[model samples]
Target chain A: MNDTIGITALVPPELMYACGKRPLDVNNVVPVSSSSPSNKLCAWTAIWRDMILNGGLDIDSLVVVAGGDCHNALVDGQKAELSGMPTHYFFYPFDGDTDYLRSQLEKLVRFLGGIQDERMFSLISDLKAKGRALDELRVNDRARGSDVFSALISFSDLAGNPDIFGKTLDSVPRTDIRYSSRVALIGVPPIYPDFHETAEGFGLHVVYDELPYEFLRLGGSSLDSLASSYRDYSFAGPLKNRVRLIQDELLRRRVDGVIHYTQYACHHTLEDEIFRQHLDYPILTVQGDLPRPSTEQLKLRLEAFAEMLGVMS
Target chain B: MNIGLDVGSTTAKIVHVEEREVIFSKVVPSHHWTELIDDGQDDRCIVSTGYFRKKVPHCAAITEITAASLGARYHNPETQVIIDIGGQDTKVIDLRSNTFVINDKCSAGTGAFLELAAHYFDIPVGSLGRLHSLATKGAQLNNTCGVFAISEMISQLVSGYSMEEVIYGLHQAFALKISQMVPSADTVMLIGGTVRNTGIIDAINNVLDSKIEVPGAPQLVNALGAALYRERLDDGR
Candidate 1:
């Protein structure tokens, strides 16, 4: 039986699979999680940390994306490690240094017991190509944003099984989506599980989900290629690159507006102003603190944004 | 004739418009909203907005942000921004960018903050503006949190500041809390029932760089906007 490895943030699932380990993106379960962390800055890290500490998740080891991801996860991940989960800290290069990322990947490979089946890398890369196609379906208006979002977001760890995950992606219904405005959701995904559906309810169809797209866009069939591809993970690098990448996607998606969903106390929340200054689109910024269903306040903003784009524009 | 019904958190407002001109208007407590439509008007003729927009009978329901925009544009075509201080939340809408920021998590800049002060002073909320006019200068209130501001208010009173002066300080605190949300603009229109408080308007003028304008019956703008929306639907333009 393959050992299940827990990940705090975005780590190369292909490498984990090559090392004969099932990578579980812990953040995947955060939105639907009911646990209330006693102390937390960002609910994403805190809930997952508490879940691991409380024996909620079954995993052999944990990988903490300490650097270039969520700053809060560093301390929270340590709490889980202290509670006895075997842990490894992985850092993405802030300068887009492929050599540095390759070294980090090598260390991560060793932590996962080294590559046992190198073919797993190519297999996962092929699956990611399918993920990109699923993303394109929504961009082309051939799929509902909610359905596409669910499938695209899962690209992080492919639901821990390539075969089952492939079936899940294929199962996504294809249908033309009609909306009052096309909006791009940038920054971390909303903590509310039903955020995409709630936005669709207000006639604002999300055509681009930033982080989830990152999951599918960066993958390779070799360690050297993987390092180079994931090194350009926009979120880990400079804001200007992320901004440029987001601007490109927004244009490609023909978004009428941008919704920057910032997590409460997450450092990325500070980047809201920069995106507002750079992104040349109507932008509505919303913050979430806990994982739950979409709140009325959020619905009001979505409804108002849709009205503004549909009526005023 | 078209009817606009705005049932907000604190109050319910209804407006009647005919040929682009307001014919009649009325304000009632939110619970007494039924009184506004007791005349057996057709739901198709009514456009509803505010927190209870969908809950109320309406042919079309719109958000207060859109209502405020359309309503403010009717008052001033070139209106750039709008600061709506409702009972539970305050929304700063930048019409130029077609974006808005709502401060709902905290009550500091909202009408409820002022209501807390009024309840503490045992005075009617309406008289706050009149009392604000009596103060020569306000006592200092640096805290922007609604709960903490109450302590600051009590501190001001303990230091021999008059009740009117404390009210003046509270208004200043409220305006400062709201000013953080408003972006740079040439003109900002203030709306929502709370705008009827001249104290808040005065503090906003002191704090904001932009020229502040309040339409007649500022509280009825959302209702007016809802009515205007009905007209737009009729024209189908």
Candidate 2:
């Protein structure tokens, strides 16, 4: 690929595997500078900028999501673009009952030319296929009862590794483990996938979540569906709808318990009290910041919750 | 003539009055203070308060929110409660006879939240209220903290809510947060810079589910109250 077409991934998330271009978080290449320009900015923005400037991420092409700290990720994309890199921003809209991801994958594939389209599509198809294989793996282990614990323990391999994601899923037995406790992983997006794997390892299954995969998604046919509905609704109406979605998910999932992951100085996520009255299940909150949590700490928390579920039963 | 100046985090306001007749009043950009205060124009007494009050050049008196509350209550004894939200902080003042009590800490439901939301929406700070009022819908802006609210706003918008609704949701979330900080009271009058934004008042009304009365030029209520304090001290002198 020409250097001009070289890509610098600015926190693209899962779409990276679907897009055929290289994936690199800006923070991984840059160092965080003093936040004089961002003092007026929110903590998430400040942290993201600091990561890009300080983390020393390397990239030539930039892709950014439409919402979250990623909204401003485009600013970094703009800078990279100015430096001669090609950039694109992908939007995800909410109109339940449609597959936004598959369409986004198609747009991403078309943008990159046909070179990587097959590989990206194949990866997605592979994951879906593995989802079934994973079900089969779990069925066999559950039939064996005690080995179900081993299958669950093997699930932690999925975090940040797509191959592991597939392998772990394929490793679980399809049959429901008898007396297998259920827990809900609620925290950072990364932690959710990893913790879900760990839950399986502990002979407990996480049936619901508050992670990005469980909630915020971009599913629709057109680019218009990717943007916010600012032009479509009034101030309070759209917001009320957003709240109702969260409420609906929580109620619909019917998970056994919730574990809230909180970031320090993150003002918005900590508003547990605001949503506390809306919840019915027992909630366990854990606080941490990233480069990801220490493995030992995560293991302990996961196991403790699993034990708690076992006791409740 | 007496003057009161309130310096907030994002903007500043000066109120000049002579014997109850209002003179000149202006809301100036916060960082451009030197342009307005040059030459020390007058010998009259001037009192100041709020976040940027200390940044003001050569002033006669500087009082805390507590004293300002008393001063405002003294001028308008009908005032039973004070709801003041500045550019970066918020205060709920409870009046009991001659004294006023203020909230203990600065977090949640303050101007800081609005400032955060403005940046989140990529909108100018002063235009927040207008934008908020224009929003026809609302997203549940997770007002858990300033940091989280930004992320939550993005997530909410991604999920199909509008930016205006997200911004308005934040305002409502913030108003609700501040209202909970206040103890029960009646005939409440809102003060401080944020009170100038009718959208904020509307959000507060929804939060409190009651009517709130604000003085004309609500931002000056603090400065006017400070002027009242200067008058009280002069009487004692």
Candidate 3:
């Protein structure tokens, strides 16, 4: 169970994943919404602005947490530094090593206690089961249809609670839509939900999302197996490894094209040339600002990319 | 005759081709593309591209990136790169690989940025060429957004900087933004309505320190590419 935290710790809900409870999220301070010119991301800016306008924030400990890779994480750190908050910055080592990852997990475990609780084991089991259930839907040979879309949108929503997640997945509505091309989206998770809608509108069904959010993908049988899975997972460290993972999946899933979503001011999005160079398939890099839906430009590009990939008009 | 219409945000361009030869081409103030279409002319198979691409009904719709590459290939089969700096957006195409990189959601890297900056300087748009020819040093301007850039230019003007120095700086800034996107490359074939500005062309040439060619009828390249797409599809048929 200690291995579970060691594996999935770097991506999101960062260091506190070992605590076996939801971490404090500053993101909930306000709902991210739209603005003109589209690049002035309204996420944290609005929260701080609103708080100041409403006469100062009433908080004790504000800690910015990130997996310590890419600019979004750096931005979180910068925001913390600017706010003078106690922040946790976890720098991911370039060389993929279990020892490096486990050190952070150990520090976190000591800080928060609960090193070996039976609940953690049960949690892992339940999570693994839920993860398997989500993967099963990816195949969609069983008429799970549009529930797949809702299921994807809600994967993070229902990940922690295993009890009703299965029941909820069963009850969601399903509608089958024709997809002309199969696509994979990498880089930053979209700023707007309509990002997904736009791709579907362009007749490109997104089969693989490389963002760490939606599938925990705790792929292994035992604790050691889980750690091995993490060791093999390339998204953790080097660019070459991440590209390898994406390239393998592209061939395995038979993807037609790739739509990479990159946020402005983010490092990962800026250095998309590596991904483009490594991936043998056609790639369209979509750079957008936060709090805005898929723009007309992106839609036009998507339509063009889809057409270029031979999607039937 | 195959008609290709590039419907941009502020202007519309049309290219008429017959038997793979461009017979007629023109750009007009574009409120509507159908206005450019000759009355009762349905014999021409129309193709559309650019900003208002969806508004124009056509048999085939190509993206500016695809159209640029197709048009560049038609011009130079050995074409390696095409940089299009238009009013709406700037796109850098790696024609050899058929890959494209568009700038972030900002007008900073486009000709519109220069135009906006030029407007703030109160230099008549047509006189920019003569002004550029007379200017020597480019004053460093840091603001990337056109809106903020105007304020920055105002500050420079108040700070005892010559207007020519500032205007030269603005042109260099425009070229620098594009150079950042292209990073390193050989001679870049330039296209778009923005390329007609000789002042900007000189600035880009100085900044890049490399050869830049403006293919004849630069603005109509996309429209011709749209027509070429129809030509390819027709050939395939």
**Evaluated with DockQ, which candidate comes out highest?**
1
Predicted structure 2, TM vs. truth: 0.41
lDDT of 3 by residue, B1-237 (tens): 788899976679998888889998888878866678867877667888887776787887778877887787778766677888878688887755546777646788776776776677666666666676777776788746766777887888888878887887777777877887774567688888888778778878887755678888888899988888887777763
Residue runs of model 2 more than 4 Å from their true location after superposition: A1-313, B39-42, B52-60, B97-107
Q: Of models 1 and 3, which has the larger TM-score?
A: 1
Per-candidate local distance difference test: 0.92, 0.52, 0.64
Q: What is the lDDT of residue A36 in candidate 3?
A: 35
Q: How would you encode candidate 3's per-residue C-alpha lDDT over A1-313 as one tens digit per residue?
A: 2222111123222223335444333333222533232223434343443342333444333333345444344554455456654444554445756676556545444544543333444544465465455544553433232345445433332443445655765665444546777788887566655676687776777776775322455333333443444555455467777787788878876788787887656567655889877888778888765555667778877877776676212
Clashing pairs in 3: none
Per-residue lDDT of candidate 1, residues A1-313 (tens digit): 8999999889999889989999999999999998778888899999999899989999999999999988898999999999999999999999999999999999999998888998887788888888889889998999999999999898888899998999999999999889888999999999999999999998888999999999988988788999989999998899999999999999888999999999999999999999999999999999998998999888998889889899988
Per-candidate TM-scores read 0.99, 0.41, 0.77
Docking class of 2: incorrect
Give the 10-residue window scoring lowest on summed lDDT in candidate 2 chain B.
Answer: B97-106
Quick one: RMSD of model 2? Answer: 19.9
Prediction-by-prediction clash tally: 0, 57, 0
